[model samples]
Target: MSLFTRLATSYFFYFAILGLISPYLSVFLDGKGFTSVELGEIFAILTATKIVAPSLWAILADKTGQKLLIIRLGALLALLSFIVLFWLNSYWPISFCLALFSLFWTAILPQLEVFTLTSVRHSSKIYARIRLWGSLGFIVLAVVAGQVMEYYAPGNLLNSEANLFTNAFVWMGTVILLCLLISTMVIKPQRIVNKPQQQALAITGKLLDLRFIIFFMAGVLLQISFGPYYGFFALFLRDLAYPGVAVGLLISLGVVAEILIFIFASSFFKAFTLKAILIVSLAATALRWFIVALYAESIWLLALTQLIHAASFALFHSASMIFISEHFTRCQQSRGQAVYLGGVYGVGGAIGAYIAGVLWLDGLGASTTFLTASVSAFIAALLMLFWPKTIKKPSQ
Candidate 1:
C-alpha cells in the first residue's frame, strides 16, 4: 500500500470497531439485563485502562525505536482479548474482557499519530484527508451494524442463528480481526521513534507549559461531557421508540457531518486561529448536548443536533492535532501524544463514563445528564478564550 493508503487503512478499521462499540455497547449490555449504573461502570472500566496504558506503551516504543512493531502487537493482542468477550455472560467477566481490550487498544492510536505526522511532514490537508477515511469506516459500520442488530437482534440467546450473527461482541471481534489483517501490510514509517533518555526535561517542560495545560484541561472537559452520549445515546434513542435502523442512521448523520468538516478543515485552519476554532467547537458541543436534552424525542431536532457534531468533534480534533504537532518538538512526539491521549481521553473518558452512569438512573435522569454535559462543554469553551498567542493558525 502507498503511505496514504496504509495510514488510512490503519485508521479506518481502528475506528470501524469503535463505531460498533461506541453507539451500541450500552444497547448490547441492556439486552443482557445490565442496569444503567452497571453500564456506566463497565464503560468506566473500559476507559480507565486507557489512563496508564498508552503512556507505558509509548515509553517502550520510544526507547526501543519500534513503533510499528508495537502497533502490530497491540492490534493482535487487542483482538485476542476482545474475542474472550464472546464466552462471558456475566458483568465482571464482561468488564474484565473490555478492560483488557482497551488496555491494548490504547497502544495503537497515540503511536499511530506520531507515525502519520512524521511520514506526512505534518500537512494538515493530507492528515485530515487520510483521517476522514476513518470517519467513512465509522459511518459504514455504524449503519450496517445497526441494521444488522435490528434485523437479527438477540432472543433466546443460544437457540437462534440470527441472534448469533447479530450479537454485538461477534461484530466487534470480527472488526478487530480485520484490523489485525491490515496491520500486517502497512509500511512502517522510517525512524520516527523518540530517544527519551535525553529529552525527559524537554518533554516535562512542554507538558508543564500553561498553554498545553489549559489545552489539555479543555479537552478533558469535552470528553467528560461526552460520557452520556458515548455511554448511552443508542439506549436513549431506544427509550424514545426509535428502531435499530433509525438509530444507526441518526448516528451516521453525525459522522457524515464530521466528514464534511474534515474535508474543509484545512481552509478553516488557514482562515482562523486555533483558539477561535476550538472555542466555537466547544460552544457547539454545548448547543448540541442541550438540543439533545430538550428535544431528543423530536427526530428533526435530533438530526439538527447530530449535524453539530461537525463543529463539536471534527473541527475541535483537527485543531487539537495541529496544536500537538506544533507544541512538541520531534523528540517529544511519542510521549507527547501519549500524555495527551492518556490524560485527556483516558482520564477524562473514565470520569465521564462513570458520571454518566450515576446520572442515568435507569434513563430517568437522561435530561439532567445531558444538561450537565452542556454546562461542562460551555465551561471548556470559556477556557479557550485565554489560549496563548503562540497557538496560532496552522500553515496548511
Candidate 2:
C-alpha cells in the first residue's frame, strides 16, 4: 500500500480506541468507587503525563532518527500497562497503571501526525480526509461500546461494576495491541531529516515570538475550557437521570457533526483564513457550552448543542493542524506538533479537569462548570482576534 493509505489505516485504528475509551473511561472509573475528586485527579494525571512524555519521546526519536521505532515501543507499553490495570483495584495502583499507559499512549499520535504531514507536504488539503476516518472510527466504536455496556451491564449500579470495567479494559488493551502491530507493519523505513544547525537555532528563537506565544496561549485556554466536558459529561448526564444509551447517543451526535465538518473543511479553508475558522469555532463553542449549562434538561436542545461540535472541535482542530503545517519547516514539525498537543491539550486539559473536579465537589455542579467553560471560550474567541494575520515561514 501507499504511504497515505498506511497513515489512514493507522489513524482509523488509533482513533477507534479513542472513541471507545474517551466517552466511557470516566464512567468506568466512577464505577470503581472513585468520587468526582478522585476521578478528576486520575484524569489529570493521565493528561499531565502528556505534557512531558510526548516532547521527551519526540526528542529521542528526532535525535535517533527512530520515530517509528518509538511509536511502536509506546504502543507496546500502552498495551502492557492496561494488563496491570486488570489486576489492581486500589487508587494508587490504578493511578500508576493509568499514568504508565498514558505516558506511552500520549507519545504515539503527535509523532504520527508529523509523519503524515511530512509525507503529504504539498497536499495538505487532504489531511482532514485522512483524519476524518479517525472520527468515523470513533463514532462506530463509541456507539458499539455504549450498546455493549447497556446490554451486558445495564446501569452503573455497583453490583456488577467490576465485571463491566474489566471487560472494557480487555477491549481497550486488545485494540492497542492490534494498533501497534498494524503501525509496525505499515511504517516505511525513512531517515530522520535533521534541521540545519543555524535553522535549529532560529526555530528555538521563534518560540519567543509574541504571535507564537499568543497562539499557544489561546490553544491552551481552548483545551482548558473543554476539561469539564471531557472529564465528567457522562456523569453529569447520569446525575440528570439520562440513561447510558442516551448519553452515548448524545456523544455520538457530536462526533457525527465533527465528521461532517471534517469532510468539508478543506472547502471551508479555501473560503476563509485559518484564523477566521478558529474564531468561528470558538464562538460556536461558547454558545454550545452555555446551551448545555442551561438547557441540559431538554433532550432536543442538548442534542442540538452537540451538533455544534462540528464548529467547536472539528473546525478548530483542522485549522490548527493546517496552521502548524504551514508555519513549521520539516525538521521542526514533530516538536511543533508535540508542543501544540502538550502545551494545549495536555497541560491545559489537566488544569481544566482539576478545576472542574473542585467545582463538582464543591456542589457547583455540571451547569456551573459548563458556564465557566463558555466564558473561557468567549475569552478565547476575543484573543484569537488579535492573532497576526500571517505567520513567519520557517527559515530554510
Candidate 3:
C-alpha cells in the first residue's frame, strides 16, 4: 500500500474498534449484570494500563529504530489478548482480559503519531486529514451498533439485554480483527535517527517549563471532565427513552462535527494561535457538558450540544498535536506523544471513569455527574487563559 493509504487506514481501524467500545461498552457491561461501580473499576483498569504501556513501548521503539515493528507487535498482541474476552464471563476475568488488551493497544498510537508526522514531514494539516478517516470509521460502527442493539436488545424484547449486548461484543471484536489485518498491510515506518541521550535531569528540566506544565494540566482536566459522557452517555440516552439506533445517531453527530472540523483544521491553525483555539474549544466543552447535564432528554438540545464536539475534541486535539510536534525533538517525539496519551487519556481517563462510576449511583445521578464535568471543563478553560501566546521551539 502507498504511504498515505497506510497512514490513513491505520487511523481508520484503530478508532473503528474504539468506536465500538467508547460509546457502547458500558451498556454491554450493564447487560451482563455489572453494577455502575464495577463498570467504573473495569473501565479504569482498561485506561490505567495506558499510563505505563505507551512509554515503555516508546523507549523500545526509539532505541531500536523500529517503530513499525513495534506497531505491528502491539497490534498482534492486542488482538490476541482481546480474544480472551469471549470466554471470560465474570468480573475479574474480563477485567484481566481488558487490562492485557489495553496494555498492548496503548503501544500502537504514540509510535504511529511519530511515524505519520515524519512521513508527511510534520504538516499538522495533513495529519488531520489522515486522522479524520478514523472519525469516519467511528461514525459507521456507532450507528451500526445502535441499530443492531435496537433490533435485538430493545427494552420490550425478551432477554433483549443479553441479545443486544452479545451482538455488540461480537462486532467490537470483529473491528479489532480488522485492525490487526490492516496492521499487516500498512507500509513499514522509516527509522528515526537516534540522538545522544539526554540526562534524566535535563529532560526533566525541559518538561518542567511553566507553559508546558499548564498546557498538559489543562488537557488532563479536559479529559477528566469527559468522564460521564465516555462512561455513561449511551446508558443515559437509553434511560431517557431513546432507542438504540437513536442513541447511535446521537453519538455519531459529534463525530460528524469532528470530521468537518478536521477537514478544515489546517486552515484554523494557520488563522489562529493555538492558545486561542484551545481557549475556544475548552470554553465550548464546558458549555456542551452543561447542556447535556440540563437537557439530555431533549433531542434538539442534545443535537446542538453534540455539534460542539468539533470544538471540544477536534480543534483541541489539533492544537495539542501541534504543541507536541513543536515542543519535543524528533528523538523524543514518540515519548512526547506517549506523555500526552498517558497523562490526558491515561491518568485523566482513569480518574474520570472511576469518579463517574461513583457519581452515577443513587442520589447523585448522571446529570449531577455531568454537571461536575462541566465545572471541571470550566476550570480547564480558566487555566488555558494563562497559556503563553508564543513558545520557543526546543532544539533536539
Candidate 4:
C-alpha cells in the first residue's frame, strides 16, 4: 500500500484501541471491584506515564533521527507490556501494567504526528483527511466493543464472573495495538531533511516564549475539563439506567461529530484564525459539559451535547496541530508535539481523571463533577481569547 494509506491505517488501529480504553476502561475497573478513589489513582497513574514517555521518545527520535524506528519500538513494547493485564486481578498489579502500557503507548502518537506533518509538508487539509480515519475506527470499535461487553458481562457487571468480560477489552486493545505496529513496519520511512541544530538554550528560550506558554496553558485547561467524560462517562450513563448499547452510541456520537468536522477542517482553518477555533471549541466544550451535567437523563439533550464535540475535539485538535507545526522550527517539531501531548493530555489528563474520581466519590455526584468541568472549560476559553497573537497571518 501507499505511504498515505499506511499512515491512515496506522491511525485507524491506534485509535481503535484508544476507543476501547477511553470509554470502557473505567467500567472495567469498576467491575473489577475498585473503589472510586483507587480507580482515580490508577487512571492518574496511567495518564501520568504519558508525561515522561512522549517527550523521552521524541528527544531520542530527534537526536538519533530514528522517528519510524522509535514508533515501531514503542508500539511493540506497549503491546507486549499490556498483555500482563489478562492475568493480574488486583489494583497494584494492574496499575503497574497500566503504567508500562501507557508509557510506550503514549510514545507512539506524538512522534507519528510529527512524522505526518513532515510527510504532508504542513497541508492542514490532508492531515485532517487522514485523521478522520481514526475517527471512523473509533466509531466502529466503540459500538462493537460495547456490544461485546454487554454480551459477555453478566447482569449489573459487578459479579466476579461478570467482570471477566473486561478481559475481552484488554485482549482486543492488545491486538489492535499490535496491528498498529505492523502498519508502522510496513510504512516506508520518509527522508526527513534534518535542519541545522540550534543551541539548547535558544531552543529552550523559544519553547518558553510568552505565546507558547499561554497556548499550552490553555490546552492543559481544555483537557482538564475532559476528565469526567473520559474517566467515567460510561459509568455515568450506566448509573442513569442507559443500556450498554446506548452508552456506546453516546460515546460514539461525539466521535461521529469529530469525523464530520475533520472532513472540513481545512475550510475552517482558511475562514477563521486559530484563536477563533480555539475559543469556539473551548466555549462549546464548556456548554457541552453544562448540558451533560444538567440533562444527562434526557437522551436527546445528551445527543445534542455530543454534536458539540465537533467543535470541542475535532476543531480544537486540528487547530492545535497546525499551531504546533507552524510555530515550532523544523528541528524542534518532534519535541514541540511531545510537549503538547505530555503537558495537555498527560499532565492535564492525569489531574482531571484523578480529581473527577475524587469528586464523584466524595462530592454530591457525577452531575456536580461535570459542573466543575464546565467551569474549567470556560476558563480555558478566556485564556485563549486573551492570548497575544504571535502570527501575523493565518497559515491556511
Candidate 5:
C-alpha cells in the first residue's frame, strides 16, 4: 500500500471505533439503568486517564526515540484491555475496564500525530487531509451503529448474551482497533534522535511561557465546552424524541462540514492568522451550542447548527496543530502534541464530562447544560484575543 493509504487506514479505524462510542456511550449506559451522575463519573474516569497517559508515553517516545514502538504497543494493549468489557456488567467493572483501556488507548494518538506530521514535513494542510479520513470513519460508524440499534433495539447495552447491538458494537470495535494495531506494525518507525532526560525537561520553560499559558487555557476551556455535547448529545436527541438514525445523521452532518473544511484548510490558513481562526472557532462554537440549547427541536435548525462544527472543531484543530507546531522546536514535537492533548484535552475533557453529568439531570437540564457550554466557548474566544501577535517559531 501507498504511504497515504497505510496512514489513512489507521486513522480510519482509530476514529471508526471512536464514532461507535462517542455519540452512543451515554445512550448505552442509560440503557443499563445508570443515573446521570454515574454516566458523568464514568465519562470522567474514561477521560481522566488521558490526563497522564499521553504525556507519559510521549516522554518515553522523546527519550527513547521509539514513537512507532510506543504507538504499536499502546494499540495492542488498549485492544486487549477493552475486551474485558464483554464480561463485566456492573458499574465498577465497566468503569475500571474503560479507564484502563483509555490509559493505553489515549497514548497512541499523540505519538501517531508526531509520526504523521513528520511524514508530511509539518504541512498542516496535508496533515489535515489525512486527519479528515478519521472524521469520515467517525461519520460512517456513527450512522451504521445508530441504524443497527434502531432496528434491533437491544434492551441492554452490555453483558447481555442475546443483545445484538452490544455484541456487534464490541466485536466491531475490537476489529477496528485491531486493524489500527496492524496498520501500526506495517508503518516504518519514526527515527527521532534520542533526547536526554534533561531534553524532556527542556520544555518546561516553553510550557511556562506567557503566550503558551494563555493559549493552553483557551484550548482547555474550548475542550471543556465539548462535555455536554460529547457526553449527552445522543441521549439529548432521544430526549427530544428524535429517532436513532436522525441522531446519527445530525452528528455526522457536523463532520461532513468538517471534511469540507479539511479539504480547504490551506485556504483558511492562508487567509487568516492562527489566532484569528482559534478565536472565530471558539466564538462560532458558542453560537452552535446555544442553538443546540434553544432550537434543537427543529431538524433544519439543528442541521444548520451542526455545520458550525466545521469551524468549531475542524478549523480550530487544524489551526492549533500549526500553532503548537510553531510554538515548539523540532525536538519538542512529540512532547508538544502530548502535553497539549494530554493536558488540555485530558484535564478539560474530564472536567467537562463530570460537569455535564451533574448538570444533565436526566434529560431535564439539557438546555441549561448546553447553555453552559456556550458560555464556556464564548469565554475561550475572548481569552484567545490576548495571544501575542508574534509567535515563537520552532528552533532550527
Candidate 6:
C-alpha cells in the first residue's frame, strides 16, 4: 500500500480507540464511584504525562533515526499498560495504570505525525484528507460505545455493583489493546532521512523564535480552553436530562463537522493563508464556547454550534501542521510536534481540566465552565493576531 494509505489506516485504528476512550472514560470513572475531583485528577494525570513523554521520546527518535522503533515501542507499552487495568481496581492502582499507559500513549501520535509529514512532502493539504479517517473512526466508535453503555446502564443499578463498572473498564482496555496491535502491524517503519546530531539545546533554541513562541502560546491556550468541553460535555448533557442517543449525537455532530472540514481542507488551504485560517478557527472557538455556555439546552442551537468544530479544531490543527512543515527543518519536525502537543494539549489541558473540575464541583455548572472556555478562546484570538507573518505563508 501507499504511504498515505498506510498512515490513514494507522490513524483510523488509533483514533477509533481514542474515540471510545476519550468521551466515555470520564463516564466510566464516574461509574467507578470517582468524585468529580477524583476524575479531574485522573484526567490531569493523563495530560500531565504527555508533558514529558512525547518530548523525551522524540529526542530519542531524533538521535537514533528510529522513528518507527519508537512508535512500535510506545504502542506495545500502551497495550501492556492497558492490560494491567483489568487486574487493578482502587484509585491509586487505577491512576498508576493510566499514567503508565499514557507515558507510552503520548509518544505514538507525535512521532506518527512527523512520519506522515515527511512522507507527504509538498502535498500537506492531503494530510487532512488522511486525518479525516481518524475522525470517521472516532465517530463510529463513539456512537457504538455510547449504545453499549446505554444498553448496560439499564440492566445495572448504580451504587450497587462495582463489578459491572470493572467489566466496562476491561472492555474498553481490551478494545484499545486490539487497536494498538492492528496499528503496530499496519504502520511500516520509515528510515529517518534528516536525523539531528546537534544537542537538544540547539533545537530548543529554534522554539525561542518570537513567532513560533506566540503561536505555541496560542495553541496551548486553545487546548486549555477545551479542557472543560472535553471533560464534561457528556456529563453536562446527562445533567441536562439528555438521553444516551442524544449525547452520542451531540458528540458525533462535532466530529461530523470536523470530517467535512477534513474532506475539503486541502481546497480551503489553497484559497486562504494559514494565518487567516488560524484566526477564523480561533474566532469560531470563541463563539462555539459561548453558544455552549448560553444555549446548550436547545438541541438545535447546540447542533449548529457543533458545526463550528470544523473551524475550531480541524482548521486550527491543519494550519498548525502546515506551519510546522514550512517553518521547521525536517530534523526538528518531530520535536516541534512533540513540543506543541506537550505544551498545548499536555500542560494547558491539565490546567484547564483541573480548573473545570473545581468549577464543576463548586456548582458553577456547565454554563459557567463553558463561559470560561469562551473567554480563553477570545484571548487566544487576540494573541494570534500578532503571530509572525512569515509562518503564515506556504513555503516557496
Q: In model 1, state the lDDT of residue 94.
A: 89
Candidate 4 lDDT over 1-396, as tens digits, reads: 877899999999989988999999988888788987888899899999888888888788777777888889989999999888888889999999999989888888988898888888888888998999999889888898888767765784556668666788788888888888899999887775454464141357767788788889888898888999888888888788888888889889999999989998988887888888899999999999999999988999999999999999999999989888888888788888898899899999999999898998833588888999999999999988777774754454
lDDT of each: 0.86, 0.78, 0.83, 0.86, 0.85, 0.80
Name the TM-score of candidate 6: 0.94
- Winning candidate number (TM-score): 4
**Model 6 CA deviation exceeding 4 Å by range:** 154-166, 195-201, 362-364
Candidate 5: tens digits of C-alpha lDDT, residues 31-109: 6678999999999999989888888998788887888889899999999997886777789988998899899998888
Candidate 6 lDDT at 27 equals 75
Clashing pairs in 1: none
Q: Estimate each model's TM-score.
A: 0.95, 0.92, 0.94, 0.96, 0.95, 0.94
Q: How many times do residue backbones clash in model 4?
A: 0
Residue pairs in candidate 4 whose N, alpha carbon or C atoms collide under 3 angstroms: none
lDDT of 1 by residue, 4-104 (tens): 88888888888888888899888778767799999999999999998899989978877777888888888888888877867777999989988998999
lDDT for model 5, please.
0.85
In candidate 6, what are the lDDT values of residues 1-396, reduced to their tens digit?
777778887788778778777778877777677888887888888889989888999888778778887888888888888888777768999889899988998888998888887777646567777899889888887787777666566345655654574577567767766776676677777654653455353566678888789898898889878988778777777777777777777788889999999888878777888877888899899999999899988999999888898899988988888887776777777788888888888999898888788777733577788898999999999998997775345632
With a 3 Å backbone cut-off (N, CA, C), the pairs that clash in candidate 3 are none
- How many clashing residue pairs are found in candidate 1? 0
In candidate 4, how many Å is residue 229 off?
0.6
Q: Candidate 4 regions off by >4 Å?
A: 156-160, 193-202, 362-364
Which residues of candidate 3, in runs, are more than 4 Å off?
Answer: 154-156, 191-202, 362-364, 392-396
TM-score computed on alpha carbons, candidate 2: 0.92
